[model samples]
Target chain A: MTARSLDWESGQGERKWRRRSLWALLLLVPLALAGQAYDSVKTLLGGEDLFPRQVAWGQSAHFGGSDWKLTDLRGAFGMSSLPPDSVPVLADFSVKVGDPDLQKLWLGCKVMLIDAEGRRWSPTSAVSLKAPGDVHTCVSAIFSGARRGDTLNLRETFLVPRQATKTIRPAVGLASERPHFLFFQLEKD
Target chain B: MMRKMANVILLLLATALCYGLQVSKPHYAELIGPIPAYGKLGDAVVGRGFEARAAKVAFSRNLKVDRYGQTKVFTTGGIWAVVTVEFAASAQSTTVAVASWRGPTGLAYDQTERLSFADGLLPVAIDPGLPKKARLIFEVRPDEVSNATLLISEKLMSALDSQAEISLGPVAAGADGLPAETVDTLDLTQPI
Candidate 1:
């Protein structure tokens, strides 16, 4: 076989196949670009993880009189005057950036619960912002109540001014001298 | 080669778009925590009701020390939280075995016997058979906020008073068997 003629005859088909495959990939490039552009625009214009669900779990505390100075940390709930079961015991938090200024704000609580059987449930999608001084509302969903020693910790991104009070009731018996619910706050830390 | 370069560019663009499109922001909310809980003082400290609702709950009675501040919670039905006393007080001792009453109609002491203390607060555990919201009268004596220092803030007595009612605080023995600090019932209100 003549070298040049034989090589050409064998590889002619391979060259055609390579060229076809490369062209196909090049065509796909623009489609991917377009999809990405659409996604970015949507996100920047108020469209990202719009809502987040939180799961409540156990919490513990230790003390020796250490002070804490803090920010972006909410305060405890202590509205004892309310009727029993008027409010939720555990809640998580979400963030919302607002219009023009994109003023940072909190949306609504993500009600959290863990059943006696150790099953966990947190259902949150979207929470509407409130009209007053950048406040939002979250309602409690009835679930099996929490047991003694069980705990709920809400999200820690909201700012609570000093000594704010929140009302809550216990599902179980509570000792009058020993509080059923306890709150740990950011002091001079 | 040109086709290969174009393919690479496509993948990068797709990745960036996906990242940008997911535009949710998280706003931080602050929550306070570890409120104090007092316990283990003996049988004298227990909750109210057949269900023992106050068995483990702790409540703070707001008393005015000469009118510094006052907080009163009274109801006719349902249940009101009250502090329970576990033992008789010693004339020299200042600590009373204190607790809460569940299903309480008013702020009465826990045990059957009512031994007055130096503290103005009189905790009364309501008899369950009675009305849920008792007719309560909160009388702030002139001694309220007596220990509060305006210059140096945060004293311990007010802090305790802010939580559980003070039971056996600062007493001297009197010939009448009542602690010197104990206020006359006539001066204080009823169902305290």
Candidate 2:
């Protein structure tokens, strides 16, 4: 039990703690860098969850400033304009867009078609053709200039290649915004 | 200390190499170039050129007739070149509109205002297994009347995705080179 020996042991203990702290700090640098890289890849590949909110088919959901309900969805391969290969999917929905505080609301929202295999397709066009029935009749209402209590009937059609196991849902949002979606799961017919 | 310095330099070099490799990869646009979907009048241009066909094209200096039978007179100094097309939206449901028009001088013009005469197809919705006929109108300087080219597309917002261009032959001009007040039907159904 000499003073010099006691001082040496204490010094050794101090050095060990210092080395452990340095290693811990160095480990954090790589972890932080790996997290950043993962985020970059997700963003680049559009791996971000576009439709965080999902609604059942024929169910109603509200986002931004409007109530939306997708009533019907149909898919057929026998479109004369789509060649013999492509299939056309139609989605019918009702929207009542109006908030007293909001001056002008645009209901001309865009839609994305997500198939069973998780493939996405933007509609080739949104149309209002006159046909017999509630679904076929053209509704001449613009969602962008909606006033209080304005209800619009609309449908969007998307064309994709025909597949045996085709199932789909409609992802709705403003025409040019992202990370905001009101998804609808519609029955595949 | 010297070995530590050398190791740091090697890491820097490796980072630089990875960055160089990432940047050198070809971009999507550069690798694929532009998508081509060219077609003449009367031919069925399907998706990207699919089942949709452009038929019975008629060009007029003045918009005397429209889809709704509304006749309009242009007050602006420029004359109107109206293109009436029979666009058949064949099998699949889709959107159709007059994307733009290119003058003989290579200047481009979009559909003119929907004054008295309806401008182009009004972004109409054509159903599956059906045909739709629509008109597209453009206002251009009187001198740009002759040899104007009209481009029709499923949706202007996605023009690059699907489109067809037709060559509108010369329009009859008056003494001052302004367009004459007459309708001329040209066969642009054949590719130029």
Candidate 3:
């Protein structure tokens, strides 16, 4: 072949290789970003309440390596001690232990009421209500040290707007199970 | 050859611009730092979660705190700067947990830990619709007391959260070069 023809072929080959490398680099950019953001994305998804595992009221479901049944969602309104236009709500649950390692699995336990408008009300200490001695809060239950198959009653109190009491649903979130949490449907609604 | 020289100069300018941009960029911590809500001493500074108003400021050499019928006197090497602030939660029940006294020289003095057992200290729970008065005590140099700013927030690491910054105005100096309002002792047992 002629020298000019050989030079043209070699140049074409080099251009093709450069094009392929450019495409590979375009693909590597996202891969590098994903690698750098893997931990942050995982933490954002796993540490927040993004997804809900729905359970019918009065039915038991397994969550966070334990069997949980939401027993009641009641509201007390117009209490002399509570603030005006607010209602104090109580969410009761009975959880049966399976793993019995609550300190690890149930760390940062939260039981709150979420409304249809996406507003959430965390448990408040403003409402002073009497409960049975065996009933413990989600935080207190973690340190209760119950054995396997032992059932513990948990209670949480939230002070929310009176209008929110109608549309609110009780939810339970454990550090190990988030962004997947147990959302219970109210029987009255 | 002239075009090539122009291209080189353009590239050098671009590099210098990039370097300047990088050098002038804020630090990562400052980029995500607290959003400030500024106000004067008597003005109510409303943040996203709470509202704070600095009603008064006092200087003292000793603090007498009474708890459980026992009076304990706490002395400070420097002067004690006491700022009486009224805080109210806006939407929910929250705690005003952190406060600092920032001097004119940009030095920040955190609320004194010596008054942790004193009643009405910070980290006090504020309820919605109810305003509560609390004291922020800081042991700072006598010279740094003037032109001080009081900063209050919900927590210590309040990134991207609202922080109240109240300018205390200038303090008067006495004949001895100390704050003119400095008292020998201040009793914390009195209701704020």
Candidate 4:
């Protein structure tokens, strides 16, 4: 009888130990999944521009190692070369270089026109507007070799709907500062 | 004793079932391969991002390209297979960047990089409501010309994305076993 009683106690202990192990394994499953998905989650977040650092027109904001200010957002509605019902909107920017490595910092630079509805239009070359001699495009300005404290004029032409010009804002994104870009508020809006 | 024997048999059967499942499962690459949108040569094979229609196919031994008033001749040891394709974006502005020529024996020949300087080639950008024509050139063996397939996609690593596979029907072989309609030289300077 004593042996049987001891066997019952040991069986109960063994069952409790198995139950505890199962609960520990259940907890580890989620931890292992999170560990494996850490890099992917980081990459997904880093690749997307989710945060916008807002800067009002004529106000400078420090981004991508430079101070960027939107100087002008003009739309040419009656351009004969552009498609019907579309206008060529030029976004002009004045950037003060704080770092000499513009080429590396501004690599994969993109300037876009975004409307209130979140409709984004990239820069287009379909419009044949001869920019001013001193004005360089966002991509071309990278190779200009501007020194620190030098001011550079940059422009980007986008073909957008004429209706979108009223609410559109110019935004700048650089490769280094992706996921967090400069979104300038238009004075007209 | 009978219950022990039955349990052993059931366990053996379960193990065999698990082994069968492991052996017959699809490979990881096959599971993540490009989703194919098949069509005939003339039919428009529409993918998720773009639509492609192969208009014509030409075979030539030499290709003449003009760049800035300078003419450069490209000669191939095999044959130059030029496919004229029209592409249009479905929703947004996208670039159709990759094309390949799959032979009858499942060998894939990528669009020739020799014609990289030529305008209106692969990696051409298309906007919505506007269609663009481009050329996909490949140098392939003579036997691989018949029953060929043309594959087009946005980029090279298009896993789980749509890929257009247009079938080119059988071709007639010449007396010399080359494609019968092959031209001696193709002048790419002329507009398609």
Candidate 5:
């Protein structure tokens, strides 16, 4: 009687294994397709909302700052033999919301100017991602122009997000998607 | 027993379906254009002199010369390469000369102009041959040779692979060797 019970248990275990294998195989195809569909949809509709806020930017004395600040205007460039005052300046960027799933929003811009005498100057800093909810960016640069003159130096920075941070109500079992606009301009101001 | 088995299968299938769908967003480069002509530059300017002038960045993977403003290479009506710089004065006299860039191209298509502490900005328009707005070396000329400060910017090649630096001449007294006149220079090239 004990031997018969052992044989019965072995058969039951094998049957369980077979059933589990069948289930796994049957669901794999559908699961894979679902994932692909989700990614495609998110690509079409913004997946998230991200806001640019003031964050601490660790900068050196070469840059205009004490130790830390909420600006990130380190324009990327080669400095192998950069003569002094060789800060390559990039202007403001027009950042619009693309598509994505996000939780917050971040935006900023770099502004620059050149006065009359050819004396380079980087004044009027912009607010950073940390502008007390509204963002206050500051732009600074290490200056050394002719003893004194007229021209002022200028450069600006701008950042955008892959997705909009603002949320929308769901509809037709569809995801909510929208585009945002950021006005980038330069004037006497 | 059969009914229980079917129910278990459906539950597993449902779980799989729910876990399958998710999305991501795309980011685009800022299309900020028309970088206007600034009256002054970033900070105190380096005095005028052809610090260095070698050859154009001969080759690269994806070289870029930014034209902070200005439309296309030659679209801005009478656009030109604008340069600015600051330099030390010699109680003694001196003369500064800029170097010239030599490339496969013929007569380097660039021009030069100098402004003073009282002149404010020295704007010199480039010919239609030059790019509207970009920065870099122009025709074998050292960055600058002037009686004051100078900045030279140029734009070359639209190809991805193109980069290098130009070694310029020294900042010394002219033939006279008198304290010498302060000079500055700048380059205007294509947005390529």
Candidate 6:
């Protein structure tokens, strides 16, 4: 074949390869965007309640050595009997110290109150309450340690507004440790 | 020659755009953003150069300290949250520092040196898999008592992978379904 003809053939092959590459790139851009769009939609649909599984009141969750049972949860204005005009929610849990390991373990745990707006509320203080047939009264207790087979009644209050009460969840975690939490869902019943 | 140059420029622009998107997206993200979770004892958290396990822990207003072989009484306006952490270093040794507390208000409180005399975990270096336990103390505010998280980062602004933000559980409610209220001031004279 003539040298001129061979040069023309090589140019044509190069153009064909370039065209295929351009088409491949054009196809890839949309594919990537579709994947991203799928992720964005998924996030938009159910991104709010990701980690702490929503649970109802009176639901028992087992973690480590003890079974933490959340018995009751109520909303009020302030942390105590003194009234507030705004929003505050209180949660009560019974931590029954079981086994020898539980007695020695540090029982100082914290409760996080998450509102509909995704605001987390921690207890201002922990106290023991004396309930005389439905009338609740708060009494101060030395919250240091727990003994085995001992049922310790713990209380925590959150300052959350009334409008944000639609979806409230209480997440429990050990006071000194990091991000592993015992999540509870609030039952509408 | 002009067409080749134009194609090269387009390829470069495409590569730059991809890189921009890749860098902008986070590695780990919660749909609502990354909120810290509560962790229990014996929970081993593995970070970049170290694996840490929280051992013994205590929260008190008055810390009983033995200084210069003498028992001294040190008190705080707030509460003292102490944790005994066992840190095991990987091949790449780095300083493990107890940095800050992520309060319930979604605020970060840094370590205060007021109780520097107290014995706690200081930023120290670790060797490969050689575990070293130390006492780390944090002075927390009264309002922050309910929910706080301990942020363990090697460097101040380290990447998320190199840091471990632990969820120290919140306070439990009483049987009456309300947080038991105690007098603001803890009885410091009482033996801890």
Best-matching candidate per TM-score = 3
State the TM-score of candidate 1 restricted to chain B.
Answer: 0.18
Model 5 per-residue lDDT at A28: 87
DockQ of 2: 0.05
Candidate 2, residues A9-109, lDDT tens digits: the string is 99999999999999998998899888889977655444333644788866787754667788877775455644455666777778776562232233334
Q: Which scores higher on lDDT, 1 or 2?
A: 2
Candidate 1 per-residue lDDT over residues A111-152, each given as its tens digit: 222223222223212112222332332222112132223222
Candidate 1 lDDT by residue in tens digits, B1-192: 999999999999998887776554332221121123233322222211111111221112332222223433222111122222222211111222233231112333232222233232323222111112211222222232122111100122323221222222222434543324433223223432
lDDT per residue as tens, model 3, A92-187 = 999999999999999879887888876667788768899999999999999998999999999998888777777989988888998899999989
Q: Worst 10-residue stretch by lDDT in candidate 5 chain A?
A: A164-173
Residue B48 error, candidate 6, Å: 2.3
lDDT of 6 by residue, A58-154 (tens): 7665654666777777875444542223355677777665643542333444466665555555553222334434222112212334456766676
List each model's interface RMSD: 20.8, 8.7, 4.4, 3.7, 16.8, 19.6
DockQ of each: 0.01, 0.05, 0.15, 0.16, 0.01, 0.01
TM-score ranking from best candidate downward = 3, 4, 2, 6, 5, 1
Residues B1-192, model 4: lDDT tens digits: 999999999999999999999999999998999999999889999999899999999999999999778999999989999999999777555789999999999999999998888977888876554567899999999899999999999999999999999999899999988899999999999886
**Stretches of candidate 3 above 4 Å error?**
A23-26, A74-89, A115-119, A124-131, A158-169, B1-37, B42-64, B72-78, B86-95, B125-133, B159-162, B173-187, B190-192
Model 6 DockQ (Cα-based) = 0.01
Indicate the docking level reached by candidate 6. incorrect
Q: What is the lDDT of residue B66 in candidate 5?
A: 28
Segments in model 5 whose C-alpha atoms lie over 4 Å from true places? A25-44, A47-189, B1-133, B136-184, B187-192
Worst 10 residues of 1 chain B by lDDT: B145-154
RMSD of each: 26.8, 11.2, 4.1, 4.4, 23.4, 18.8
TM-score, one value per model: 0.18, 0.42, 0.78, 0.75, 0.19, 0.38
* Fnat (0 to 1) per candidate: 0.00, 0.00, 0.00, 0.00, 0.00, 0.00
Candidate 4 lDDT (Cα, 0 to 1): 0.88
